[model samples]
Target chain A: MRYEEFKEGIRDGIPICLGYISVSVAFGMTAVLSGIPVWAAVLISLTNVTSAGQFAGINLLVAQGTYLELALTTLIINIRYFLMSLSVSQKVEENMGMGKRLATAFGITDEIFAVSMQRKKRLSAPYMAGLILTPVLGWTGGTLIGATATSLMPPILSASLGIALYGMFIAIIIPPARIHRSVLYAVLLAVAASCCFYYLPGLKKLSGGWSIIIITVAVSALMAWKFPVSPEDEEDE
Target chain B: MEQIRIGYLLGGIAVMAAVTYIIRMLPMAIFRKKIDNVFIQSFLYYVPYTVLGAMTFPAIFYSTQSVPPAAAGCAAAVVLAYRGKGLLIVAVGAAAAVFAVQLLMNIIIV
Candidate 1:
């Protein structure tokens, strides 16, 4: 890759890397508290790059959660990435190969996808590489730091750090909500649906894994079908 | 016991990695051609938000044992987020609120 392009990639990825640092630190702290080894937590942050699923998974592991439980839960949690990947694939430069595509896909978090989608041109491989790499490092590094420091930190402090993931989520949902009425609607609908799931009898008993997947798919799909992105905008992308 | 648990953790990671890679990579690998259909494109575009909403919403309230405090905190978060407060502020605020409320409730009830 050209030096200029490489530099540009780093420049573009700054926000994502910064966000990862905070969120990953929280994940790491939680992992340590959950009785996972520091290295194991780091490995999870490095490999998974998913906050919610990792948090849920760690809790389950501590409880001696079954394999089926873990599998089902994580699957439901990460089901969104599948859809994100599908949309992001469209942004991949047409000439990009399978290996490049796969590598880029690894970095396809909500934040990265949002930023990449806003870019003017099709995302370059070097740009995507830069976007994914720093976040991976930050997440892994943060987890390692949190794990090692868990002993030094008090329980209240550790519990407080758990909020960082939610903070990140809030950060994600707010930006679009501010600009678009549709996004606001989407957030409200999601929140309302979630409450229903919690209150309803049979639904409450459903596994956390499946509940998230089903709710997200149903609500988001309904909205999308109702208010599809205009053809003109699609052409612009 | 520790060794067996460690084995399970590692095994879980391996399995997770494999499944995640496949789900992530399969679409790009299989569909090399441009997706020109409007309906399909729209479906793909909306799917992520749906999935994310589903994933995040339930966790906000039900993940914890006590519903009221967690729910209150999450509700505060949603309102703050709606108002365009920064994410860090909302998160820290909500969590602190939950922790405090729960602590107070415990003290009062006991």
Candidate 2:
């Protein structure tokens, strides 16, 4: 039974694995361009297994920001995983032991969590292991390829690829923004607040990491109070 | 460009990895019931989008070697994304747009 579920998990993870390669390739290139070495970039992907949080963390690393900023930014950006973990915990087999829970939770990325949550039956440890392993391989492997390839690429091509991360960010928020007015409002407000942080005289002094945290917190709180999301208001993605 | 010391990078990676693990593990290990707070739930629901929005803009405008191609790429991404294109399509399409613009500008300038 465990073997069969593990096979099923691997099958379900295939699409996610394919999707992660492209994003992680972008991540790898971005990290290399930011002066991170190839092996370190791969290490970041292997260990973190996150997208936005890694990107934000890497930016802070490049800036040589204090460790406090790194920790706080990671906490705020990845807090959504807490919600997914809670939901997935309910779906997991009853009385799952701490070791299995800890092992499975380490792989609770947005994609992994989403796919795991869709299963009708309780998630088995082996299934979770298979599911998590496939994508981590893709993510880390893609990063390795991209980071090593960066030195070979021409300046023009590398420059063009610079926007890939932002493009993915757009892809993430736009579909939801279209579905819900409140999401759109929250995103727009966040953008405006971000601009204030960037262009305003005094605010411009705030570091990029802090600005993101402040803007994300204030804008999200305002939206939560003003237009509380209904249970049905979740994004399809 | 400044060289990133391996030690600092490793430390930063450790911090990020640790925080990520703790966030994911705590609820699964401890929480047996759903979070019943509407405000917290709503806040979590919007956090990802809000954070992405803040990070993408302004930064995206300066992603490329210059602003014009970056703007072109951003516009292409928004249009394709708004049309419900997949993530790969939007991302590659934006890069393609930036490349095309840069190529065109190179030809014109020459």
Candidate 3:
């Protein structure tokens, strides 16, 4: 029974694995473009299976920002995982022990969480493990390829690839923004705030790490208060 | 290779990995019940979108080392994504747009 569940999880995870490889390739390319070594980029993906958080973290690394900045930015960018962990915790078997819970928790990404939550039965440790396995491997392996291959690519090609991350970011937020007024407001406000941090006199001095943290926290907080998601809207996701 | 300290890069990666792990782990190990606070729930719900949005703009404009190519890419992405194209499509479309614009600019310059 456990093996069956595990196989099912792996089957469900294949599409997510494919998507992850593409995104992580961009990540690897971006890291190398920013002067990070190829091996280091792959290591980051291996250790941290996150997209935005790693992107923000590497930006901090390149800028030689303070450790405090790196930790806080990663924390803020990844805070949504906490909610997913909590929500997914409920769907897991009630008797699930702390050890298994901890192990599965490490794999709770936005995509994994979405897929697992859609399951009709309680999630088991093996299932979560299987679901996480391919995506993790794909992400790390894609990073390896991207980082190594980037040096061989022409400057024009690499330069164009640089826009791929932002393009993916747009793709993530746009659909939610279309369906929800609150999300739309939050995104616009974030963009405006982000621009101010870059172009405004006093704010321009803030490093990219700190600027992202402040804008994300302030904009999200304000939007949450002004337009708390209706329960119905939450169900749509 | 000597441009950056390997120790420094490892330290930064460690911090990121640790923080991300703890966030994912803490909630699952401790919370058996759903968070009932509407404000907190809503805040968490919107956090990812805000972070992605903030990270993308202005920064994206500088992505290709020039505003025109980046802007063209961003516009292409926005249009395709708004039309409900999948992530791979939007990303590749934007990159293609940037490449085309850069090629055009190169032609005009030479």
lDDT of 2: 0.83
lDDT of 3 by residue, B1-110 (tens): 33779999999889999999999999888876656778877776777777777878788899895999999999999999999987668888999999999999999999
Which of 1 and 2 is ahead in TM-score?
Answer: 1
Q: On residues A13-76, what C-alpha lDDT tens digit does candidate 3 reach at each position? A: 7756766776687889899999999889999999899987888878889999999999998887
> lDDT for every model?
0.69, 0.83, 0.83
- CAPRI-style quality class for the chain A–B interface of candidate 2: medium
What tens-digit string does per-residue lDDT give for candidate 2 at A46-82? 9999988899988999999989999998987787677
Q: Write the per-residue lDDT of candidate 1 for residues A48-167, one digit (tens) a residue.
A: 777777888788777777878777777766766676777788877898988888788888777677556656677778888876777677778878877787554455444444444554
Clashing pairs in 1: A216-B50, A216-B54
TM-score of chain A of 3: 0.68
Q: What is the CA-based DockQ of model 3? A: 0.54
